[model samples]
Target: MHYTFSQYYIYVIFVAVMAAFSYLNKLNRTEVFSFFMYAIMLLFAVLRIDTGADYSTYIEMHEEAGKSYFTDLFSFTEPLYFLLLKVLYFFSDDYWLMFAVVAIIIYTILFLAVKKLSIDPALSLLLYIIVAYYFISINQLRQSISLVIFLYSISSIIDKKPGKYYLLNIIGFGFHYSAVMAFLIYPIVNTSFSKKTLTIIFILSIVLSPVIEKLFVTYLGELDTLYTKYFDIEEYMEKNYLALGKVIVPNLILIYSLIKFKSFTRYEYSIFMIYFCSIVYYNIFFGKHIFIRPGMYFEIVTILYIPIFIKKFFDLVTGFIIETLIILYYAFSVTLYGILINGGQGVVPYKLIFSR
Candidate 1:
């Protein structure tokens, strides 16, 4: 497939526009532009073709949906996910239409989630693009949807509603089994772990990564195909893996951010703790491709969290400098060259459905 890095400039331009509106401090225009920016992201997802490696995966799944989309719940496909396929089946056989509808749902939830949780929604959006969190929707449709559903349920986590939180995440798990990893969110966020315990876990995770992988396979590998098929360390070693840039490094910075900024509110602290679990996961599974995928469910929180970190932790001028530094890092390090070098998907050579 032809690949080009030029499509990333679109995101760069979006960030530029977002920064301009943010600095302008015009509530009405900023709100309108924020909505517009999200719409553009949704439209990008809707219009793309073969933008990611997995784009064809969903297309093939949709193509086969007529034969087996409704085979059984949890046996083959998740209920809500299968329903989406079936609904789109009636409208047209083309997967692109289903993709478009999914785009609307995914981006709508994401926009709403960021808008509500983020102190600066536009900055969150900018960070979303910078962090390449949007790749989930463009690439992994089912899990991305599942992830957003669980993200929407963050209120339950903040409100101390374990029953409600797990229920939503269980529903999310139906769509993508990986979301079951989120069950840990309830305990991690709800319970108060000391800095000592947190530090110990983080250190052990890095030092014990390979050991943990072995134990994971030894204990749970046979429990389900999830472990045997996906988490098999042997298979992972053989396949050509793609790097999404030193995934652990950015996360480690979050640890520093957490330590440096101690003024977080209860709500913010809950979010921080939730993300704290993700970093631990990444630290343990950093070098592997499959193992760290689940960690992304937590890493997405960085989009909102980072923006809040900048605003709360720095004065206006310092925040601007910090923000500029981050943007530069994203431009050269994360979003642009990082993804390009890693062969990360969804934002390259910007193909559209219309092109066909």
Candidate 2:
């Protein structure tokens, strides 16, 4: 189960080239590179390298359903994604087409969201690339599509249109039920955070960890039973629990920074901190299923704030060399952890599409 040296070599070379181009383009901030980056990431997604078994499950269901029946109508938790994928499956069996459609949808929604936020296009593009490359690789059909819908819905929230926001979530939930939880967090979207509030939330997050798990396992077990054929409790817990540390550590730092700096808007801080706390608490007790499952959706919101904070941090720090080093560190570390170690978990392995 070891990757051949050629595999490693090719990955290293591809990343090195992309990094170099990224660094060079940061100077001019060209639109060409941004588009190029989008295309590359989309192509990678289509290749379907390192895709999870859920995709195969999706294809099988579609093939079995034929034209007379809706294949995923009952078995699927997310009706929106099921329907979307079913439509795409009609055109071709190539999973890449599905990936490409999702990538385009996500990119379009993100572009609109960031532009409305008044964030710089180049920075937004960079963050989108990072997300597309690092996060959307594994669950190409389910998670990625859900993420796009979720982000579009979040952007609607930013516009102060609650009706549109909830509508999108409803649509998204048809694709994945986990998306429904996102709607639950809407009321607190723009809530203010004080030192006292922050402390309380953090303390509550820690304290509620175990209690939440007990309740979920006991009460929500019915939900699991309904989808038992698709989900295994033991396996879900194992994968999520193992990955908890990876999500919590960085998130904690982000939370601490947000509080200390007090830079984010009240709504921005509230959503990020609340979601961050939720993820940590859920992961600590209930395991990764509660964390990683929702964590992908959370990332879309959190990522929007990251570059803004990074730019603010750079402005406050006032050292060009240090900023350069910080960016480089993130690029290399994120790329390695995201791609190399995780088998490019979120990255589409274009080379493996036909191989699989």
- Residue 315, candidate 2: C-alpha displacement in angstroms: 2.2
lDDT for predicted candidate 1 compared with the true structure: 0.70
Error of 1 at 168 (Å): 1.8
| Candidate 1 per-residue C-alpha lDDT over 111-195 given as tens digits, one digit per residue, 9 for 90 to 100 | 8887777777777776677666675567788888888887788878888888998898888887888887788777778777667
Task: Give the per-residue Cα lDDT of candidate 1 at 60.
Answer: 81
- Model 2, range 253-302, lDDT digits (tens) per residue? 56656466656665466446545655554445444243456656665554
Reference-based TM-score of each model: 0.83, 0.73
**Model 1 CA lDDT for position 244:** 36
The residue-level lDDT of candidate 2 at 188 comes to 64
RMSD to the hidden true structure, all candidates: 4.3, 5.1
